[model samples]
Target: MTIKPLVIALGLITGSVVLSACNSTNDNKTPITDTQNLAAQHSDAKPVVYQVFTRLFGNTNSNNIPWGTKEQNGVGKFADFTPKALSEIKAMGVSHVWYTGVLHHALVGDYTEYGIVLDDPDVVKGRAGSPYAVKDYYNVNPDLAVNPANRLAEFEALIARTHEAGMKVVIDIVPNHVARNYQSLSAPQGISDFGANDDTSVTYARDNNFYYVTGEDFSVPSSQDYQVLGGEPHPLADGQFTESPAKWTGNGARAAQPHIHDWYETVKVNYGVKPDGSYDFATLPAQYAQLDYRAHYAFWQDKKLPDSWYKFRDITYYWLDKGVDGFRYDMAEMVPVEFWSFLNASIKMKNPDAFLLAEVYNPTLYRAYIEQGKMDYLYDKVGLYDSLKALMQGKGTAQQVLDVHASVKDIAPHMLHFLENHDEQRIASPEFAGDANKGKPAMVVSHLLSQSPTLLYFAQSVGEDGSEMAGFGKPSRTSIFDYIGVPAHQAWMNQGKFDGALLSEEQKALRAYYQKLMNMASFSAIAQGELVSTPVTTRSGQSATNVIGFGRQSESQRLVVISNFDADAPQTVSVTLPAGWQGNAIDRLEQHGQVALNNNQLTVTLAPLASAVFELEN
Candidate 1:
């Protein structure tokens, strides 16, 4: 499993859009036609991503001490995702299992005997540490293993288990930044740590792994009211974490002492991008936007890229060889799109069907990242997620969802939808809708609105409120930074049985609803169908602002979906069907009486925060 580092010297390489046809070199590649492309695009079931915060998923420890140690809180191991658990997750119609925080990260734990270096408390976020602050790229987190020495093997077994359960494995790859004390103890013999060969005298070098703040020693940021371990005493809590010639913070903060709000625990990786916002590497030609990943990979084959680019690419290959299916790139927009074009092209060359999902928030950059950067999917955070959140909080109307969907309709299939993730506030939280039921209609819209992947955070079904004041992570979001137990998720775990024996009736019903919706959403018609937004109006002909109507049509199926956002009142609305849509509407969700249609319009009544999927039968 050894990867030889790219030994290209520093040199400027210009890129051109190769408009010429792909060379017929016998590289064992098969030419794909237009029909094949379309068929390949929709060949599989809709990807239902189940994102589980790895360490917290199976942790049965009810002792959720704020900023508690792994010992006190009892951290879950990679072994906890047993066969039963994977089967249960697969039963939810999940196509992918995102094992978040699988990488070795800077954590407040002692593994000195295992030859792992101790991370200073000042730089570490919580007891378990922020998963994004990756300390090593070549190894799994020791805290996640039953035996620290066999951590990587344990993770490999987990990957196998996930695959055996008929689900793909997705892990995080924080390419934009890494831990402030980045040290890859498990790196292969030839691979060197980042900044090892760097000329730190200059602020920005073309090949330097990180941007150095020359002549300035790094200083720990002012914590203000926040204490390093909740004011608890520890040897490393002496307010001193050393780094000479400080590198820029992960958020691109150039200060020697970054603000407390800045991502001070991690340092940004330089991908041939200068501090003046100029690219140090060759920028992809605008014409290259129309090219495929293979062409993109061919273009960069001869070009000398930045060392950081090779490093991340090699890291990706390392995981791919480990049988890990795909990656969820963090803060992908922060990295240069050109770099993605090169790296993702290389990934595609190795594994064409690899699932590449990224966290890209800018609506303007969506097309570039997807079409040019070769990303399979990007987070629909700023667009659909924000609109849905506002609607749930009573601050917006259902029209906003339609508008947001319309804005990115061209690339809707590449936009991944989600109501909750590790970063977002839980729907059951006081700061959010404060009721799990409020997410029903939103989930319906998110899942069925487009031909895109849907991410379901762990315990989102049983309604985890995320109300615990878990150290650095405040209420409303599950604590990714600390060692804590998720009550709702634990109830479903049922002591490793992976059954919901301990769940309340409401919780049980919510889980069942999620399972049903997920399975239905996986259907070929709803998953890969073309969507047509239908008009919805009240009986009096006024726009039904609280209701949204849309139709998903395929060669084999035609379905109409309507959701009521209003949480207090039931609304009867007239949905104008697509032209030439003539059929009996059968309720797929509730199996209610047939919906009557008059003059191409169907009238339906929906309770507050309820949704219906009507299968149009000819």
Candidate 2:
């Protein structure tokens, strides 16, 4: 909506990638009359997301003990998110900051000094617990606060600071489950804890917050050598925790003692689902799929909702009231889609533009989650991300990226794309691409492949290999369960200046490339452009399967993006431009020389694992 001339100026200074002037005639801006108008506003400005594990983002401590106490391996605090740090993040072209692990979760820390009871080590995952195993919905994690008693206030200050830096805030809302000891010490008056009013006599109840296994006490799993806190001697690590009438594990394990592989630290929340997985509540009508959130909220207003539904509704409202812009639901597919309809509808009614993203891996359920559940976006992990990963590892081809895009073409705009996240392996890891630069080509394609938001993990920009040998978190991922400092990212932190002052030359180049690509993608032309596939064909050269090409176009601007997937081979490929798309080529990614078009066809040779984004206009 706020079209600026700066994009055109930047484009000119950077070789004028496309020939069209940045300023567009009002005549060419067609009015959107449908609900898509709300979505279109997003297209005009590209969304760059920087995800940070709040506990690790600002921790300058390099003493990374695998299973050490918070004292041994320091933790990051809300106070660490200084204005200067946030400014640097914003300067990196980020629109949203996903502060992971901001909520109160069951952890191994002893907070008894602050009037909070100690978390049993047996039930907690590691020194820093899994953020997904939320314990208190109303309070911030005590570990993240500079003053343990002022944790919530500290979090609020961070939110205010993030907004001041022109970035929206996104926090996790793990709907599928909660810590086995589901107690909220800071719940607002008149609110009750989960299962407080439930009848434990029955195995299943329509209003029960959790499913019960009658006559059984909770017991620890027998197999697997893994232990809480890595088997460090502790008074609470005696392999026992108390739970009367054991509940089902988060992963739907019904056994009194779940297997070691099961999510033993958390218990699944029942959302009006019967023991047999049948719905016990009314579902949204098929006609409600296209309705706005207000309508969906109205439809459920007069209806009798489940207890679990009201609890989640209250939780989300609490955050929204605290200036939280949106939520990223964890393992959302495990919860029924109907519950999401109610939950998301309530949030949207309060804030119409709230960003609601969910992790739903079932490709079969992507559409249902987006349309029926009224979600803004769903992870395209199984589609776009998987295809790209395979192609990067030489196990697949560029044709697969095209195929995956075609499969999700109808919903492409609603799908969020990312090459790295806390859940995925780092692209630079030995198990992955084995080099940092390999991510360049993949990033160019991923960000420009569609008109959707792109996410980058905390250390991803600096080429953090994510290789670590920790007690809880597996190697090849930045440790989310342990108190660990990311070496590459810490260098960028540079003792709180956050200017990447200590980064290596290659690391600096990688970060610069990301900034350029992200800034280029932020231009209205690429952000709001309609996607067009311009497949490359090998002509009069050695045939190779290492190239991929595509284009995006607005009424006045067009950009052609091509990348060589092979790390060892330079590729030569040809693409025929659409009629009326003519201009001197400008390499938008690196601001290099032009590649002229002849007979409406253009050919380019790229260095190994290199990419090009060329702008074209008549």
Candidate 3:
């Protein structure tokens, strides 16, 4: 058996928030040896935190609260997510909880004094959705307030509750765009600074202005894509485009203007330009009544957003002082990298150990965001892309998966790795899981990627069935055509199965085996083991291309993880265990899969889409 390693809980100092952790006992009696030597080698070592989705102002459903909403339905009192949500997350042994969509909703005007209107589809999916597109930067969504407390008190209390739960809270930030319901645009109160645009230059800001649907210059008649909010008509270079009122699925996203609804909804901020290299907004307005008309939106060369443009910088210490652990940046790529570098430093100045996770979608290369250390950890797309590809096509060797992992390791936090998130399709589906008949290869690779931290989305542990209606921008419903079919929650109930699920009676046993494996390893160096690639037997065909093997070792812990990408047959793999690897090693994911050193020669049989985690027995 491997010796138990020492625990150093005070290493992460970027914005170090104290973690109150419970004793982590194994679920079953699987006395795995300690693997502490592994932690010293991981230069990118940090804590692994789990994230949960909570809806903002839209979802009022008492039982079904969408991911980003802050309020509960059929209830007048504010949604109390503090101790309630953190307590449940802590119960699962997770040290951190990422609470999404708790910010103030600047979307709706004071129709309800809270500024969040339930009528907008963008805010709520079919009247209940996760909050992504934001409107205001300050204040808490009134639905998140239990008492008549200010934004500061609510946030401070939330952080304190999280700390008290023996955990940390990672709030979401959207630097890309805000719901265009501009409290900032309203003259005395609104922020009308779009770069260099002037009051006379409103015509240059036509992209954000409104127009009539059939207004003479508008070409398309009834298509739902072209949106025209009510206000003033905007003239584009090609022709005048008008707005559509019903584009929003449920409520709205700057869907309607002051003339239409009592509540102010969301608006669409320009991403700076149209794709065609042409500036949509220019200094021109249509002559109303053959005389003169007002320009739609004033054009501003506001490419560089001022600090006061958004409340991101202003609200940093507010929550930090309240004792929130950190901020996991949402869409870090959307904003300039320079901005985050400054923010992360500023946050560190206040409290080190403030973790920063950037949501760089499908960024496997890691060159741009991860290497810079603009934030602590960025998303890993290697496993998600290649694993899904291998599972669906039943092609490629395990080497492909390893290559991606190695690449992901370079540019990203060595500790960072994730499979499924709230934004993507569930891993429990056929596309990434292969067929229901045999076990899914992607699922195994997800868990078997050495001891690196793997993120588990809320429904991922239980199982989230496929969605025909699920969309990246808009969350869709499950298609009746799919095998999982309707009745909704039933698919999730069977633990992600149409009929032939990925986890077999044998695989179910393996799942328990790995949970114990993770619990034991987390206490030692295995959580942050150093990654090193094993020499390839053949560098050529499916056999040559398919198998990918790598070993993660520290002073005490040595583990070899082999994942087969080919679906048809077992890939032949010969991985030699590295030297000085004296420790008790076992396959963390597979109970029977293990390799002992006979002059460091080990031959492993890896099934297609399956991965095995090996531990070194000293």
Candidate 4:
């Protein structure tokens, strides 16, 4: 099948969009497809929004939230937020609610002192580490399960309640590796070697698929690709931050440790082994191999895991019974396409409308997930990343934004958008949040022109100010490696920790404004409208990067957004309109003066580190 055109695409080849002093304007261009109308229609399409993750609602915690109990911070399903939290997100006009870590075991918890993950041997201790790394695919950790007393039915009830509340629950599914204490590989009949698993009941041939490597060429990736020479062996393995595991270590890919490696009980699956890169999906009861992996995947992939690990198509009765609206596969990169076909095909067959959000990142790896009808919308990381950077850097002009829209309109009208996720650094990573206006535009622009199915991380909504404490290796940001910024910069995070935000007052107002825009998009034509642009002229430089202005127009309504990208510059510029557009433009924000747009052209004045929006004649 040929590829579908994108709903929002990158015109990156139009050359890089850098904030500049001035550039020539193109007023004669009309894009091939009328995105303006489509965007208007799309605004009515609700965004399938999901949360980051929370692991405190485990069986042992109070209220037994599954990942954590009410007593244990009660934030159990962070992404699965409480009624109050749900209301907050719903207020934002969002759809899907993803209570991230709603699946089975794998000891979770990292003993975080705020943003900093303490040195626990295994890293999955009780301070709420990411819920992605699974411990047991079948067994839903009692803590997060709806009711530990009755795992099966309770789990069903949770799903039912989520549906009743008008939201679909999405869980995390990892096909890479199982818990280190995986009962299948540690049994007596097991050879303590390949081919024989802990279950001892099934041989390696029948146990499912995984690759095991015996030697070390193990290179751990800790820093950015450009900065780091190569992936290095973690000097801090499990929990021993002091000692590095050198030479060829024992055969345990990842294992269960005491205080050291307590949190995660996983063994990373080897994607490189079984050379020639062959992965058997051979046929029948071996269509069964694919089937088994699917069954395992379904368990931890939602907020409410099923009581038992059952086959995929067969699981439909439970899904309808549970009232689930979708499934978002985790770590989809490692799963083979042939195997994934059944997943998407089966779900659509079961309910035709089940939304599938696969965690496949790379284009080559996620192609099948996107094109095969396997997923309604796969997460587009680079696309989201680029759009976010463009706005934050104050470079995505009206031309830049529309050029992007023209490109991706058909590829997938609805794609998942994001800034920071559980796996990456919180946007507050000092390296990125270098702004005094508190980085509000970063958050605002993301949700504003983003594709549908947007993802908002834990601290993103509130502009939670701070940095990542579980920063995988770099003990410090500098040579001395001391906790200087944490205590002083983030007093709220009294520890040597930082908040996950940097939103300014204007940025906050902008965020509220865009949020309204998002809601308008949800029920209006903004999302599906045909996109058109109006250009604004401004000088850009180190202090003037903040000066940006542009207009996005839909058939029924035409709106203009303008802002100063630079935090330090004070300046003004002239803006031009589309060929047929005309009107007395009104500034959405209080501005000093107004410009008369004549024959589709208008000269306007702007302030430093400030923005304004104008509404044109409908």
User: How high is the CA lDDT of each candidate model?
Assistant: 0.84, 0.80, 0.42, 0.42
Q: For model 4, how does the per-residue alpha-carbon lDDT over 493-594 read when each residue is reduced to its tens digit?
A: 222122213444544554465356446445232354333444556544222234445555555666566665555555676666777778777765445445
TM-score of 3: 0.62
Per-residue lDDT of 128-194 in model 2, one digit per residue for the tens? 8888888899999999998999999999999999999999999999887899977888999999998
Candidate 2: TM-score?
Answer: 0.93
Question: Per-residue lDDT for 595 in model 2?
Answer: 85
TM-score, each model? Answer: 0.94, 0.93, 0.62, 0.62
Across 1-618, the per-residue lDDT of candidate 3 in tens digits comes to: 000121111111121122122232111111111112113323333354676544321122323322212232222122344355455445544666776656654322123453343333322112222345444455555544455345547666667777888777777766544543323211224434322132222322333322121212212223244232211122221222233332211111222222222112223233223222233322112121111001111111233433332345556765666566777665555443334444554565555556567765535223334322235556665454545455445565555555555444333233355555655555556555523222334544444454544565554444444443322122232211101122222222243232224434643443344344334335333455456555545423124465556666666666676666565787666676556554445776654455555566566666655667777775
**Prediction-by-prediction clash tally:** 0, 0, 70, 101
Give the C-alpha lDDT of model 3: 0.42
Candidate 4: residue 473 Cα off by (Å): 7.3
Q: Which candidate, 2 or 3, has the higher TM-score?
A: 2
RMSD values for the candidates in order, in angstroms, are 6.4, 9.0, 14.6, 11.5
lDDT per residue as tens, model 1, 1-618: 001121211221233222122222111112211112323545767788999999998899989998888878878999999999998888888988999999999998889999998999899988789999999999999999999999999999999988999999999999988999888988878999999999999999989999888999999999568898898888998888899999988888888998777788989888887776778777788767777887898889889889999999999999999999899999887888888899888998898878889998767677777767888889999888999999989998888878877777656777799999999889999899999999999999999888778999999999999988778857899999999999999999998888899999999999999999988755667666777767899989999887888888878888889999999999999999878888689988764568867789989889888889988887
* Residue pairs with backbone atoms closer than 3 Å in model 2 (clashes): none
- Give me the runs in candidate 2 sitting further than 4 Å from their true place: 1-43, 541-544
